[model samples]
Structures are given as structure tokens and as C-alpha cells.
Target: MNPAEGAGSLSAAVQAGLEGTGLASLSAGVRRLMDAYRSGEVPAAPVLTSAREVAAYAAYRMPATAAATGAAFAQMRRGLPGWTPATVLDFGAGTGGASWAVADQLPDAAGLTLLEQSGEAIRLGQAILAESTSGALRGAAWRRWRLELSDAAERAAVQDSADLAVAAYVLGELTERQQDRLTELVTGAAPAVLLLEPGTPAGHRRILAARARLLAAGYDVVAPCPHQLGCPLEVPGDWCHFAARLQRSATHRRVKGADLPYEDEKFSYVAAARPGVGSPDCPAGRVVRRPGQRKNLVTLDLCDRDGRATKLAVGKSKGEAYRRARKTSWGDRWDDAATG
Candidate 1:
């Protein structure tokens, strides 16, 4: 569904909140902060430092972030349909965008705990949630705490044992040691964890690092990649990311100064569940790139369960497979049942 056509209740509430506030007041600050984030620099302090900044960010970035997060979670559901999470732990929940994504996907999720450092962000998120029709989000616990990977006590406040734990766009600011510590803490707390980053090369590397750590800790891989083996994207000059296209609402376009009706949010993510918990079965591989179509042939690049990348060609003479291939968009999956 297009985000503009069907925004989650929390997102709608966020938009309403931004509209009530002077959203344009902090537009310049939001643009500057976003540029820094795009450049891969994690600031030491909160980017949204005031009501205006928080509102500006909510108006400008929330839709795209929520859309990207929902796409990642959809992949997780495809891989683990049997895994129904009752609770979620959102780390660094800026205006609770990711939490809203979780709520949109996991309708039965009755609990939410958001850990964030900035009081301003927390207040804005609470305001949005209060305005939301979603009972889960409205009832969520907004915990104001700094993220400290070095301190065990502090890390414990990150909701150590939720059914699902999410860290969206939060790892880039930390050092390697901090990342490792954060991973250890999260893995210890939750049986299932989802980590998301920007679509940049650095973001994919972060996902790879988390994947390795999770696998070593006895977690099973789910979504995007079908196998637990080392990533095949190790070749130089290559990275793995997925794109999610979201429709831009009028306010969203105005805030971001984007004239396009739709924007594609690119993200790299890893979702994994521990050994005892069973996940649903999905396709053995995913179509990582857009299928190229010619007069009669559809060509695709696939990432397989064996941790290999291979190209496949389906001609018009190929019957049903070709017909199916013609319908696939990027970030879609297919298996032997359909193509072999």
C-alpha cells in the first residue's frame, strides 16, 4: 500500500502533531541535521533539540523512515510468519517512527517500550501517540535514558527481553566496541532482533557485522538473505540494500522540498531469531535487483540460500515463469517451487 494512501494511525497522529506546531520553524535545522546523517556522521547530542526541530523532523523524515522500516519488517514477516511478537523494544525511538512501523505490521503486539535520550523527542513522540487511535502505541512506555553500551545497568533499561527488539538508524554513531557491546546486550535480552541502517556501504557493513554476531550467538537468519552463511556481498565495490517506495503527502513534500510524488527509501537490515523459536518458511533466495525486461526476455540477479549470486533468464517462451517474472519488482523473492 502507498504510505500516502494508508498511513498508520500513529503516522497520521504525528502529522497532526507537526501541523499543530510550527513545523517550518526548524526546517533549516532539520535539513542540516539530515545532511550530516546522510554523510554518515552520528552527532554526539540529540539532533532534534527543541519542539520545532522535533516537529520538523517528524514532518520531514518520519514518513520515509516509517515506510522503510515497514518494508524491512514485511520481509521479516515473510521469513517468519509464525513469529508473532506480543511486545516490541524500540531503541533510539525518534518520534517513535519505528515503533509506529512495528505497530502497523504487528497488529497483535500489545506492548511497547521506547528507549531514547532526548526529552524533546520523547515529548513529541508521546504527543503523537496520545493523538493516535492505536491502543498499543498510545499505551507505550516512553523511557528517557541515554544509550550506554559500556554500562550493563544502563543497557538493561533498553527492554532486555521483548518479543522483538529493533534498532533503526541507531548504530552509525557508535564505535566498533560500542556496536559489539550493544549487540551483546540486545542478543542477550531478546530472542529476536531486527537491525536497520541506511542503504550506504557503511550501513551494509553494519548489517553484516550484526549478522555475524547474531549467527555466532546461535540465532537463525531470517529475511532478505536465506542462509546463515557469510554474506556473498563481500566482493569489493559491492553492497546490499533494498528499496521501498513511499508516496509523499503534501505536507511531507513541502517539508522535504521534494517535488516528486514518490520517494524510494533504501535501507540495509538484518532480522534474526534464536534457535528454539521457529520461524515460517519462505523463498530460498531474493531478487536483489530490478528485473531487466527486453522484448521477450526477463533477466534477474538473485541472492541464493547457498550464499551465492547468480543471474537467471526467463524468455517469453518460458511460459508461467516468465509471466511471473514480469510481475516482480525489486526486493522480491522467488524459490524452486515457482522457478526451478
Candidate 2:
């Protein structure tokens, strides 16, 4: 289905997603409710997270998600530090883990607003905040974090005015129309908005769309190419997916209590914001290409000046069936005579 056509109700879209899919399971009643929400056959209400200790058939991924987001925010600080943003809006702030990422960074900021439409999410955010900041909350100017259950449109008028706005992995949950609307909302709220995704093709596609919109709107892009460049061919598929594996610690595994799926590459993200119009030095990813090389040799190079790349060797077209070389090496580093 076209994502753009479903922009009117973001909640309905998410409610539908909560129903069930091959990747995740949902109860039959929940499926019916979600379907009704998606079709707009019924009015939507905020649904909170069940509970912190609500026996999950799986582990509570909140801590890991929160930790990863905090790390990403730290990277954002390294990239830009001149602006000490006063107000922040965390859009699609599921359970407030990403919001904690923002709050942790701007500990002294005046206002931290967590905008979520789910009642469950709102409750979870409040509970986590209460537990995490019990004593030190008063040290921050705005000791109390604001949890509001509101739609994106309702918040758009005052959106981009924040110092920094973030929409992390949440973009994947949004439909096409909702994605566009949400982007516009964040851009409206603050001069600099950071959009992070799972680093999948679909995730990258959403970031690309935001880049196009922000560029046309005159916002400078900070990280990742906003130029909408073609794929780099790092993998065979349309998107890049790597495995991330972490050994189960006794304490950690016990906390999660499920056979955690730890792949080598679990997540990826891009940091984006309005570019300072005249400021140069935009970092770009490396691109490798070979115009003409030996039948089995591929060239290694980067398209950008700062971009760096290495190459590997693989088999050329075959008669019966095609196959790849056993090992690959950086194309430029390969000694042609020795390689041949």
C-alpha cells in the first residue's frame, strides 16, 4: 500500500501494525481492533505499554534500545556542539527510550517534551523517568519531563522551534503519508532535526526522502549524504544488513529471560539536520567503482575526497554457471601482475 495515502491517521496505521505479521505475533482481538483503527471505522484512544515486568514471552528490549540511542546521541554531540538546545521534542517516542537519549545529552536543557499518542507509552515514560531520576531530577531546570498524548498535526504549529528534534527508528513505524507529515513537523519545530532509521533499504529510503525535503527547504545536512546518491553495492540485496552478536551475560540474560536474537548487525542510523548554508566540509560515505580492470579484478575507490574504499576480486561471467572468487582484496592494493 502507498504510505502517502494513509497520512491522515498515524495512530491508525500503528494500530494496524500491532495486529500481527509473519515477524511478530498478536492476539486475535488485538488484530480486530487494529484493523478497525486502520480503516478509521472506530475512534482511536491511547494504549499504554502493559507494564515494566509484564511477563514478556521475550525479553524487555527497552534498556538495549535506550543504550543504543544514547550512544547515537553522543555521536551527534561530537558532530556538532555549538548549539545548546533549550527545547526538545521526541517524536514517536516509544516507551521514551529515545527520549532518554535526548534528555541524557541535554541534562541542563530547559524543556524536554516526549510526544507519544499511546497511553501505554506515556505511562511507561513516566514510570521510567520516575525511577531513573528520582533524586537528581530537581537539578535539571525542568525536573519534570512532559508526556503528552497528541497527534503530530496538533504539535506541528510549534514543532521545529526546538533546538534539536529527533525521530529515531520510529520512522519505520510510520506509513508514507505519516512519514512526510512527521518530517514536516520536525523541520517546523527546530532548525536542526535528526532522523535515524534501522539502516535497512526501507530505512535508508525514508532518510533519503527527508534529505530531499530538507535540501529543498534550505536545511543543511550534517551526516550521511543528503544528495540522494545511488547504492554503493556493499551487499547483494537492495539494503545493507549485517549481523550483531552479543554473548549472554548471567545478569543481562536473566534480565531479558529469553533466547535473545543477537545478530552481527542489529541496527544502523544516520544523523541529519539543517545545514549551515555556507559552511563546507560535509562528510560523505565511500564509494568504490572500477571502469576497466582485468576480467576478474574490481577497482577500489571513493567518490568523495574524504571517502575511502578498497576492492576484492571475483569471477567474471561463466559458461555453465557463475561463481565468485574464494577471497576478495582491496582493488587498488592488488598487485595486478601478482593477482593475475
Candidate 3:
């Protein structure tokens, strides 16, 4: 489905899940949750401890999470073309935001499994997904599984065969060692893996670390990166990330106490697949930043296949290239062949 339609469906599902919820309680829960997230420290206990908190989280965070994950999924689809996962495993699934995002991309996937620790989260997730039109989502299995790095049985259980495994916005909650272990678990579960985190320097670093591990495991880089070479933005004060803009609903605005009709969800992600599973259609480069346009010139900041970040200026003299460059936005694949 198109993005607009998918978003509408997601909004409807969330609204359906939120029916009969108390707005005052939801707003209070949102404030507390926002404070915890803003503090940047991992909570020692489950964040969604009650139905009110779960409802608040679903109404407040699900849309943005889905939008960001959808953006990442879009890139993955573009890179892999005809490839589709028959089964999907979503680790740290939360309210199944990542699963919904995957459903938006591959609606016909036969199976989906969501593993989360919080029972409340699982309950709300099941309710939210039950409202989805996609059969895969409606039939998704919600498992209450805590991430324990050293538990052999747990690890084996999480390694169920699947085509794709996703862990989005959940890395921050783990220790560095746990993060590494989770990566191992996901990679063991599926040939293809996608990881996403907030678009912060620390988040980018986490993704870069996971990317290195995936490459070491012989997986091919699929999206955002055109080549398997080391990241060029690894230097201090620079990080690779992308943004997805989503419209805020009335409930969203009230919970966040924001008047803006839209919000941009910035995220850092890496999608990789084992050898022979999938390969990226190597573009000339990717637009790493917003394109700047002038009267007759467009400047694009690109991370090219050579693993270098540089700027390209397309002037009116370049004809069609200039037109395409002018229309290009951040996070777009920059194909020199198409431009020329």
C-alpha cells in the first residue's frame, strides 16, 4: 500500500485500540514516560507497567515509531526489490510498531512473531494489531520473553526460523554486552536483520557497531550504505542518520502538549542480509543531507559507493541532472546514471 494509505490504516488501528481509554490518565502517563525517555537512562523496571501507561504509550509513540520504521523499510524494499520475507520476528516489539511497519511494506507475509517482556505491552500490542487489516498482523503471535543474554534456552527459543528479524528503538534499554548478544540472537533467527535507533550520536554509534558485527558475520549491507567499506561519518561530531516526517493526531498533540501538526522522527538504522539472501542495487550514492537549491544550482551532500561523504553541485548547465537534483530530498538514493 502507499504510505498515505498505510498511515491512515495505522492511525485507525491505534484509535481503535485506544477506545474507552481515559484521556487524563493517558496524558499523565505520557508526561511520565516522556520524562523517563528524556532522562536518557535505561529504566530498571518495565516502562509500561499498567494499562493506562500502555494505552498512553500506544497513543503517544506508536505513530512516530511506525513512521520511522516504515521509512527504513522503504529503503530496504528499494534495495532488495522482489525479495519478501515469509516470516518475521520482531524483538523488543513494544506495541508491535515495527511489525506494523513491516506489514505496511510486505502485507502478505505469512507469519509474524512479536517478543516483548512486558505483559501489559503485549496485551495492548495484541489489541492494536487485532484492529489491523493485514492478516499477518492480526494473526501475529505475541510472546512474553525477556531478553536474557546468558540463558541458553531463551536464546534457542528466540532463534526460531524466520526470514527477517527486527529490533527497533530497543537497543538503548540494553547494556552494550546485551546489545551485542541481541544482535547475535536476531542474526541467528533470520538471514535478514534490520536494526533501528533514535537519530542521536550514541544511537548512530550503536548501529555502526552492529553493522561491523554483521559485516564480520559475512552479511551484505543492504540500505543507507552503498558499499561495505567502513562508515565515513564515523569521525567525531558527525553521524549517519535519516528523518521521516509524520502528521500528529489530536491525541498525539494533547499528550505531547504540542501544537505542531507534524513532527519529524529522526532515526539511525542498518539493514543487512546473509550472503545469497539479498543484495542492494548499488546506487551512485545516497543523499545524506537535505538538498540545497539555488536559482539554477542544486547542491547534494552524498555518501557515495566509495565510502566517502562529499558534495555534488548540479547546475542548469547539467540539464536534467539539475532538475532531478532540485527535487531530491534527504535520504534519497542518488543514482548518477539516472541523473545524467
Candidate 4:
């Protein structure tokens, strides 16, 4: 699919919804609140939203994030040793929406644990999992999935229980103290953890803090190079926004209704793994095509390294379209310029 073309509609809808949300007006205040809480100058609780709002947000963003997360996990899967454990955990698993992100990719994983803190959230997640028709998690003989309602206190008990742990857009909700506690739990429970966050500045800050703590604890850096560089923005703000579009099944569209949007948001994320007997060896950066070209030529440039690159020319397209003046003299000049 041509992201440039399809993205316009998705972008317009997202922009409209975001504008209606008054988030632009609240961002500065939210950032201030987050900063104050981070510095211990103020105490703040996790910002709560309506169930509908959470569902809308998840429905709009899950497809893209899940696809990207799955791809990243697939890349890392190549580097894992045969002896890597078969069980996995989804820590801070909200409604278990994200387990679908990596579920199919790690088919060999025998046990799947969804560790959530809220009984309500776990129930919602369990309901969703039970309704899936793909049988992705149910058919495999080694598969065993369960939702466990617990907090940081249970971390040590399940320490080293999982080969992989995922915290998708969960860390930003915690206070500094809680973030630290959860970080410790993740580092101890699993050898590799994919920490996903919203593409917003506040989300980035949370991940940045967690990255520091994880690195300090000796976790090996995988994708997303510059595991150490600070934010580059002269003045901080949201850096990037991405979207993922998938064809909705008839039943899905009917159940969700046309009023509910189908496009998904693609926020930025980083996948980190532990040292030895771990994920694929690679760096992370955006894939792009060559200059003055319209074809679908793809390349993955590793970040944090010098100006190094690897390229692959995948598909081709016709030359760009244009219009010229009717005048013969002007047309002649235009033709000459085109030839030149």
C-alpha cells in the first residue's frame, strides 16, 4: 500500500479527532505535570480516561503498533538460542490488547502470562482473547495463556519466569517510584523486554528514563540505536506520527460500525534484549527510498553508527506526472529542461 496516498485520509481523521480532544491545549500542562511528578516536586496519580476513550484509542492505534512490534520481534527471533525459555509475560498488560502483537510471532512460546494490576482490565482482556476466531493462541499444543492480576510485589516470585516480556505503552502511566519498581521487575523477570510507548514527548521521556535504568542494569541494546543519546529537539514536542491500515473483515466492521474508525496509529517504539543467547543483531532506523525516485525501494539504515547504509531496490514505478503551458515556445523550453 502507498502510505503517502492512504495516509492522507487517516491523517485527516486523526487530526480532526485530536483537535476535538483539545490535546494541543492540554499538552503543555500535561508535560508540566509529568515533569513536576518526575522531579518529586508534586505527587500525581495515573491520568484516567473513560472506557470508550481507551477503546477508541486502542482501536485506532493497535493495528499499526502491533504490526511493527511483530516485525521487530521477528527480527529478534533469529538470534535467540534453542535453549531460550518457552514461556513469556506481558507485564502491565492493559486489557491484553497487545498480546496479539507478538502472539503469533513467538509460536514456540509454551506459556503466555498476562500480568495486569486491575481486575477490571484483566477481565476485559480475557473476554477479548476468548473471542478471537483466528485460534492463533488456542491451537498450538504448547500454548497456555492466563491473566494474572498482580503488581510489583509479585515480581521476585516470577523472576526469570519468561523469556520475553512486553510493556506496551504501560510505563508512562506510573509514578517515578512505580516506574523504578516495575523496571526492576521487568529486568529480573525476563531476559528481553520490548518497551513500547506513545509517540508523544511525554511518552518518550518515560522510555528515556526506563532505558537509562535498564542499561545501567546491564541489558544489551538491540534495535533503536543511540540507546544513550538524549532528545535532539531544541524545544521538545511530538516528533513523529505513523498510521497502520488493514482491511477490516465484514464482521469486524459490522460489530464496530462505520461510525467507529478503522485506521490504526503507529507510534514509535524500541525493542531491547539482554546479552548473550538473545535476539537478532541489527540497528534501527526508518526505511526509505532513493532520492528523485518514486518506486518502492526499501532500505534499513542502522542508527547510532556513522553515515553507513544498506539498500535494496524492490519494485518499480512510472515517471512522475506534470503539466506544461500550451504556448509552443514555453513548451519547447519545458521539453528542453526535461531533457536536460
Candidate 4 lDDT, 45-66, residue by residue in tens: 4322344333333333434456
What's the TM-score of each model vs. the native?
0.93, 0.58, 0.95, 0.59
Q: For every candidate structure, what is the RMSD over all alpha carbons to the true structure, in angstroms?
A: 2.2, 12.3, 2.2, 12.2
Per-residue lDDT tens digits of candidate 2, residues 1-340? 3331133222122223222322222233234433433453212333224532211111233444554565555545544556556677777666555665566667577766666655555544454454443222222122222223356546644555577777766666666776777777777778777777654666666766776677676776554332334434333564422222333322234433346533222344445566652233333332222323566544333323232233333345431111222232111112222233
TM-score of 1: 0.93
Return the candidate ranking by TM-score, descending: 3, 1, 4, 2
* Cα lDDT listed for each candidate: 0.79, 0.47, 0.87, 0.48
What is the model-wide C-alpha lDDT for candidate 3?
A: 0.87
Best by TM-score: 3
TM-score of 4: 0.59
Prediction 2 TM-score vs. true: 0.58
lDDT of 1 at 104: 78
Global local distance difference test of model 1: 0.79
Which candidate number would show the highest lDDT if scored against the true structure?
3
Clashes of each: 0, 27, 0, 1
Steric clash pairs (candidate 3):
none
- Locate the minimum summed-lDDT window of 10 residues in model 1: 1-10
